[model samples]
Target: MGPTRVRDLSVAAVAVAALGYAVVTLMYRHFPPITALSGMSLAVVALAEAGWGFYVRAQIKDGHIGIGGGRLHPLVVARSVVVAKASAWVGAGVLGWWVGVLIYLLPRRSTLRVAAEDTPGAVVAACCALALVVAALWLQHCCKSPEEPPDDAEPAAE
Candidate 1:
């Protein structure tokens, strides 16, 4: 019972956090552009979230009780989560690629300068940097298979 309660609380917290994050992002929509570090950070955060989201989603799939009162299966949930992650990566990648192109085409000044001077452009550029970060992360980690035989090399029973 305690464990379940804790899980519920944690899930609730994540939900609220996600909402707050969205709101903050929206509020900042009119602001100056993001810095290189910040852009990279956003991508890092998204990648981390997507990965952890898949895990939480997988847990939710593995079955317990939904906050809404329903039975669930981890496999199905994980598959859906995996698809979402893939989609996010794709979008981030394309967007980032374009942003990078723009940045490259821009003048000798820093991205931060451009972002502060032109919010929309900066935002797009920041997003591009993030996409690149995500792509790097994906290249490094996304293709890995979670399952593998143990090093002992014991054959499974027939």
Candidate 2:
């Protein structure tokens, strides 16, 4: 067996759960059709978004963080990061009934583009990606990084 990615596993689980919910909802459309379908749609949306989110993260991996040379170009990497962040939002919006508005509020065009490496396209891309991640995690209830460690904490007493 090989190591499995947590992000991939989570996305798959959400999708499977959504599929189950859909089957059950479909079985009872006559009893509560509209409400059930609406809920079902939310599940599906979340599954799709999470799947893509995991994919984006998988594509970037650890080595390309600063956007140096790699199989995925700097431009593509930037787009992937944006899409990942969007995926996170999509999941939240689906669960919370506000995905449509949130999608509308996002910037749909490239923040910047340059063929020549004269400018740090990759750098800008990385910054945008990091910002998006922070926003997404915040919206999803993840605690932000601690501001400062206890000054007197003695290196874990090791």
Candidate 3:
């Protein structure tokens, strides 16, 4: 499979953002308040992926980890790539969702106590989502084989 492209991620984000906005707008009166903990799961995933990426990169670069009985498994790398791509897409979607919520709440904050209180949580969630995107992208990059050409580059002469 190919690497995740920014265009695809952007499209996903936009679509999710629009949906989030519509849902929140339609159900604002009955919607539960967004709490800072809403993004805790995402935060944990982001941290784990980022840390794993660094570890994999270091091991692969050493040349000792991927050899003998201690060989770095190819399946692990492939799975990491898949996870990174999925995480990036999911993160983008969440970020867009929070942005939608913020857009809906900002103007109403002054007159709506709930809006004012929820704004902080939404903002934090948005930031964490953004961080997840970055972390996932970094993990994807780290997972690449050193000898492989970049997705956008022309093939080298044989």
**What TM-score would each prediction reach against the true structure?**
0.33, 0.28, 0.87
The global C-alpha lDDT for each of the candidates, from Candidate 1 onward, is 0.45, 0.38, 0.87
Best-matching candidate per TM-score: 3
What stretches of model 1 exceed 4 Å from their correct place?
1-72, 97-101, 108-116, 119-125, 128-158
* Candidate 1 lDDT trough over 10 residues, lowest sum: 1-10
- For candidate 1, the per-residue lDDT at 145 reads 32
Full-model lDDT, candidate 2: 0.38
Best by lDDT: 3
lDDT of 1 by residue, 36-110 (tens): 443445466556555755555454445452454554444544454455445444445444433443443344345
Please list all clashing residue pairs in model 3, or write none if there are none: 66-72
Per-residue alpha-carbon lDDT of candidate 3 for residues 25-117, written as tens digits (9 for 90 to 100)? 999989887899887788888999999899889867876355458777888888999999999999999989988888899999999999999
lDDT of 1: 0.45
Pairs of colliding residues, candidate 2: none
